[model samples]
Target: MTTLKALKGQHHVSAITANAMKNYEFYTKILGLRLVKKTVNQDDTSVYHLFFADERGNPGTDLTFFEIPRAGHTYYGSNSVSTTSLRVPKDASLEYWKNRFNEFEIEHDEISIVSGRATLAFRDFEGQRLALVSDENNVGVAGGKPWDKSPVALEHAIVGLGPVTLTVQNISALSSVLKDIMGYREKGKYEAEGHEVVVFETGEGGTGAEVHVVARPDLPAERPGRGSVHHVAFRVENQEELIKWANYLKELRIPNSGFVERYYFKSLYFREPNGILFELATDGPGFEGDEPFETLGENLSLPLYFEAQRKEIEAKLKPLDTREGGKN
Candidate 1:
């Protein structure tokens, strides 16, 4: 029985999007995050899977989207990842974003202290729930480096992911999976809109690696579609450790997708007791493995298994011009 190292902080959050073109423009031009990977969803190659992140697409910085052109609206409710947080440099960054959001006519809330940090809640073009959290007091997991070329100034740019908010009806069950099985510890609690949000942290324990769970027993289970989160992945050291975790899940009779090779990084996918999809993924053999660092997201990238059908795949996907900056 090899003891696995504790899961590192948050890796990435995969969400659904109805329009990849607009998503690309909004994330890159407005948010100032780099388009790190331009690829198709492995499960369904007909659709695009875009990755946005800090300069290097570091493990903790990735925010991905799976384009489903005909996907329906997301009915807000329980048993879902309600809001995804992005980390900015410091507290003052919120002020810059507040004005930027106004200039772009992006719907947002006023800056306020939530879960002991300054946060600004905002929605994207399709109403994807998001928040910008300041790393002014973050001491645990360090944030990533923002791209110098981002339209947003370097001082106000988003660095990496912050705490993800999960809304569930059964908090006890989800808490057991996060604690007993995954080894996260409850840090504290805060109140928001008449609901209590319980904060949990793992690895080094900071904004970069926290999950804020709020019990919403009053609402129905979410009807997921575009603008909804697909899944939240936690960081693992490597494929070896990922395999160990797969075995551990099997030993405990927790059903999981055993050892999946995702090309860039290996993964193990499973559902928590509350039905939110969760993934454990390796941190290396990253985005740069298949594409060069200088021009990572300029073209459509595919795994070796799918390379043979590149022409067919390209035929199905609508053209998306990602070579906006010329070259990194």
Candidate 2:
């Protein structure tokens, strides 16, 4: 089989959290992604499952959430297991995020470049490690970074993710998964923050092409708690493609890390023998199907299970802050 060259796109990366409302404010109000979908976890009701993404709620722009059951406080272990980094248009990083954070009074740390690009590092409301990188080759956004109060002109803000970091005890197993199953090509290796990080390039790396995997040797394993990465999703072409990878994992005898229908995509999950979790995600029938861009995340979008309770659903949902954030 020809080794996979690059990821098809990013569907959604999920995280477990304690407060669904808090997640809403941070991702939609603070980070500036649109709350494309809001509903309860079908697997378990009473727990909120949310999604945030770019203008049209495209597959690659998606970042998802799962409110865990009676979650406990979290701790950030040694090194970051995974960091969701978005690719921004060159020159938009400093002005855009700097002023945006300052205006909102959101605290963040600035890094010109940890490895190969100008990056601004910060934590989200959920304590997720995130970065905004001004990629030299960024193609910019179609709607011109539609979020509000950005220091840089909307024309040059982040279009979508540039890359990401995934931790593993050893690179051998995870690396093989990346090369054989995920279609990622090793870009090169670089030293940063006192650790050697390997970078992989996926797609054009801006829209559907932006995926990155790193072999984090020094990062300690993070216990799944209130605040931790629940999962990282790598996009595939469709359900058919998702099945092939799912069977491949089964053939490898990788345990229950297999495909599950996620409404929009199909997914398979497994941990590298070293204990790092990995997933193969698919993309289709994305967020726009439920809501328009101008009014996203402002209302409740439920699955068929909750269709009869739109009123109950809308009433139960916490009110969306009507305040137009200057820096969101």
Candidate 3:
């Protein structure tokens, strides 16, 4: 078996949201993530595509969304990404977030230790599950860049993405895919909120490396809609690694969208055994590719191919209120 080498950590997590403004408020105002890009979905130009991240909009920091008002609520069940966890510095940092959430009236659970790390669970306005995991080991945070202007204190700002949890019908094949093909190793196991969970870690076993699988065979299959995760993307070093990943998938007889140029980064998408969508994306040619860093997210950005239709696309999108200095 060929051992995977290029896979690093999470590249970005993309999900669906019903309202662009609401999603923006939650991630930017509430969570204090930087609004890195304001664009439209490449495949569906009518809906807005938003990207939120830390200072530089680094690979692991990105959490993107597609706005589709009529998409309806998500049906959570087997083969769905259940939660996206953001990493915070240990104990003191978690305390800061707990107080911050309370001050803002954002609902969150009490801190609890899971898989040997303290975690604070919460959900966004649209009911998209999220959590804040305290990583005392520093994990991937040593290299994180914080947005200085964020409402939250610099020391306590969300460092980066932590482990993402997936609910699957069976863990067998998915476990093999993660371990063998994805280069993740089984770390530990624990029960969380009444469900049996298994932990898997990617490169170096830190913040962005964790992937939690929760077996839920009795639940119905998930139906995608608003607030559902569209796909969970893992990071590859660059385009070369992305292409290699695509070829590797084919060698394993796994069906995938080979070598997709996603504008910001190259990507390859494939569905795991339990139907959860996974993507391997490159790290370069980021948010600043279209707009200057200082003016990022100020105006709608379109790919080169869509430049000719910019006027039509902008006319269709609902006007966004980008005023700063207050919570929604």
Candidate 4:
């Protein structure tokens, strides 16, 4: 064991999008999140990798998307990161969002309580399943600051990410990876949508530092496509801690992507036993490292490795206007 520390909380959740323009509009305009990064998917430079987060693109606030134009609709099932949660300032914020969703004709469910928190579940234009979790009762893993210029009021704006829900066919298999390997402790269990949801939390347990797993053996394995989660990344301190984790995974004989540089942060990736992709990512050298805070995501950003190829990459990607004061 490296003996550094347990993983902090969720770093980010990356999903798939068929259209980056629409994804950008919906997340930044309707949902009121800031488009913190406009970059290409490092794995496949032909498409965009969009990051939406709180004002500063803080560690636990990012929700990213990789554009795959030809990707089909997702067939929801087991062995997937099913729902990504965003945190609001308080329980009352749920009512604000519910009304906002209705005004925009955005699909959403009524406010409901889960795991002792008020949550409102909704889908984006492409049916990306997401929920806004209330922080009225939250105690650990503090959320980030919402962008001041967001159309949504500051008091009701989303702060950071909340618990990500994982659906698996073999609960024990995933549980072992989360508990035995990742150091998440079983927080509690609750019944929802006809299944028993087991909650687990890592450092400083709260809404921001938890994962809710539910077994769905009755359903087939998920067919991933647009609107489906690609991976959920947990927080590590920095590159040094990330290196320790790489060594730790190596010592355990677990296959992993060793110490990958993401410009914004260092990363290591691996899949849990249930086949759901999980990542360990660092917290620093944030989004502002390259772009100024005033216009963070206004332009396309590229890592140094791709800067030489910028003209070619820019030609392949469709132009996305993320400048402030766009249509709301």
Cα lDDT of model 3 overall?
0.84
Q: Show pairs that collide, candidate 1.
A: none
Candidate 4 similarity to native, TM-score: 0.98
**Residue lDDT tens for model 3, 1-328:** 4345747878889999998888998888878888888889988899998888888788898999999989887888889999999987676888888888898888889988878888899878777889998878655423367687787777878878888999999889899999978888898899987988999887767778889999889999998888789999998888877777877888888999999888988889999989889999888878788888777787788889899999999889989866452223
Per-model root-mean-square deviation over C-alphas:
1.3, 3.9, 1.9, 1.0
Worst window of 10 by summed lDDT in candidate 2: 137-146
Provide TM-scores for the models.
0.98, 0.81, 0.95, 0.98
lDDT of 1 at 219: 97
The models' CA-based lDDT, in order, is 0.93, 0.63, 0.84, 0.92
Model 4 lDDT tens row, 105-205:
99999999998999999999888999999999899999999888888988999889999999999999999988989999999999998899999999998
In model 2, which runs have C-alpha deviations exceeding 4 angstroms? 1-6, 78-80, 139-153, 204-219, 292-294, 305-328
Q: What is the lDDT, from 0 to 100, of the residue 202 in candidate 1?
A: 97
Error of 3 at 99 (Å): 1.9
Q: Which ten residues in a row have the lowest lDDT in candidate 3?
A: 319-328
